[model samples]
Target: MELWYTEKHTDSVKFSIQVDRQLYSGQSEFQRIDVFDSKEFGRFLTLDGYMMLTEKDEFIYHEMMVHVPMAVHPAVKRVLIIGGGDGGAIRELVRYPTVEHIDLVEIDELVVEVCKKHLPQTACCFNDPRVHLHFEDGLRYIRHCEDEYDLIIVDSTDPFGPGEGLFTKEFYGNCYKALKADGIMVNQHESAFYADDAIAMQRAHKRIVQSFLISKVYQAHIPTYPSGHWLFGFASKKYHPTADLNGVKWNALGLKTRYYNTRLHAGCFALPNYVEEMLRDAE
Candidate 1:
């Protein structure tokens, strides 16, 4: 008998992975958490029956989320990550020795604990001195902050459940207040391939556009995610993702990344016509 793990991407579409064994399974106060080992993707994590990350392609998401903004903004000393409980974003962030402090606000404490125990590959950087963990509501956390961070990464789950509040216009407005004059906020904009995800992506972009001086969308391909095409939202008060990117300065850091490079950074923003149309309609 084969043990298969499946998730519904849409009403009629589903994705499945053949699992060697179920490493761990538990329910948190917020959502269900499961870890499974597979022949292809190594160890993977899921929340509420949704695929969060797989070992094989987690690098792409984490690197793009961290490096793109880091390349654009010159001095990103203080950073705030909202809802990245798995620690993949933190792992990529701690690489920047110049980054002085990191505040990670995760709503689910169980997500952090489970990821640390089962997915150490991405969870390894939690103990770094620069990382300060706060298990609280990200929405509430940002409301209390004003001009505090140079970079804010909203590595949230889908725009529902605990993450629904993060997508609202009010939340984007608060994020603007939480950042310095030149701060940049990058978030997990959902996929454009499916109708439900595309609607969510458009709504998120529309709200961010209303709040920030600069708003843009970028793409990446993560096989485990819906349709293998995922998007990230880049909103800033000053810096433009491509125009302000200092490739020479970023390359000088000599950070070896598997998916993100200065060249790819520019290319990712070149969206498809349909995606552009959707964003325009939302605007």
Candidate 2:
């Protein structure tokens, strides 16, 4: 018998991976967590029956999430990550020698513990001295902060359940306040391929546009996600995602990344016509 792990991307569409074994399964106060090993994808994690990341393609998401903004912003010393308990974003972030501190705000401590135990490839950076972990409500955490960070990465789950509040205008407004005058905030902007995910994507883009002077959307392809096409939101008070990108300076860092490079950074922002239409309608 084959042990298959499946997630319903939509009511009529599902994705499955054949599993060699279930490595670990448990429930946190917030959501269900499961880890499985597979012949193709290696070890993968899921939350509440949703695919979060697989070992094979996790680098693409993490690198794009961190490097895009890091390349555009001239100097990013202090950083805040809202919901990356898995630490993949942190792993990419620590590569920048100019980054001095990172505050990771994760709602569920169990997510951190499980990933550290089962997915060390992405979770290994949690012990770095620059990383300070705070297991609390990210929404509440940002409300208390004002002009504190130079970069804010909202590496959150979908815009429902534990992540719903992070999508609201109130939260985006607070994020605006939580950053320095020239701060940049990058978030997982959901997918544009499905109706449900597209709605969430539009809603998030709309709110961020209202809060910041510079709001833009970019794309990356992650096979395990809804449609293999995922989006990231870039909002800033003082930087244009492409116009301000100092590709020369970023390339000088000599950080070797599998998916993100100076050239791809500029190309990712060229959205499809339909996606651009959706964003325009939302505006």
Candidate 3:
């Protein structure tokens, strides 16, 4: 008999995966988090019929998501991460010894518990002392916070249900205010290949341009995500993503990383011609 696992993504959505003898399934309040053992991707996490991360290839997603901003501000100390309960972003942030504090605001506590229990390698940094966990709405939390952070990493979900407010202009404006003078905010800006997401990027870019002096969208390849090409939005009041790395020390704690490095730091910003053309069209 063929085996198939099914999970309820939403009232209107469901996800299923099939293998020779194995079946895996789960259903979230909004999007079900399901894990499957695939030969090509190893262990993969899927939400609402969409792939969020894969074990063998997670480094590319986590590294590029974290390091691009860390490298931009080599002296990043106080950092804020929104919706990164799996600890992938925290794991990468702790690599820089200069970081003294990190606040992670995650809406769903269940995602954190599930990842920590079922996905150790992906959720290892949840136990890190420097990282503080606050289960709440990130948008509301940042608005009330008076402490200005050096870096704000928006490691949230796709814009649909719970994470919809994260992409709003008012949220972006609050993020700009919640940061220090030279602070930077990085957001996962969906896929360049997705026509629907292009409008989302344009909207975010418009908001950032009005608030921050420098705003740009960068691309990374994430196999698990839709379209396989992901976008990241960087907004800074002072520094550019590729201004100068003259005497900066990255991965300062002798941390071994699979994807992010000094060379990749510069190379990640090198966008494809099509992606560049799309951004140009937006302008």
| Global lDDT scores for all candidate models | 0.95, 0.96, 0.76
The lDDT, on a scale of 0 to 1, for candidate 2 is 0.96
* Order of models, best lDDT first: 2, 1, 3
Q: What lDDT tens digits, residue by residue, belong to model 3 across residues 139-206?
A: 89999865389999998887877788998878988999899988999988877665666677766666
Model 3 scores worst on lDDT over the 10 consecutive residues at 15-24
Which is the better candidate, 1 or 3, if ranked by TM-score? Answer: 1
- What is the lDDT for 125 in model 1? 94
For model 1, residues 203-231, the per-residue Cα lDDT tens digits are 99999999998999999988899999999
Clashing pairs in 2: none
Indicate which candidate wins on lDDT: 2
Over 2-58, each residue of candidate 2 has an lDDT whose tens digit, in order, gives 999999999999999999999889988999999999999999999888899999999
Clash number by candidate, in order: 0, 0, 1
Model 2 TM-score on a 0 to 1 scale:
0.99
Alpha-carbon RMSD, candidate 2: 0.6
Residue 24 displacement in candidate 2 (angstroms): 1.0
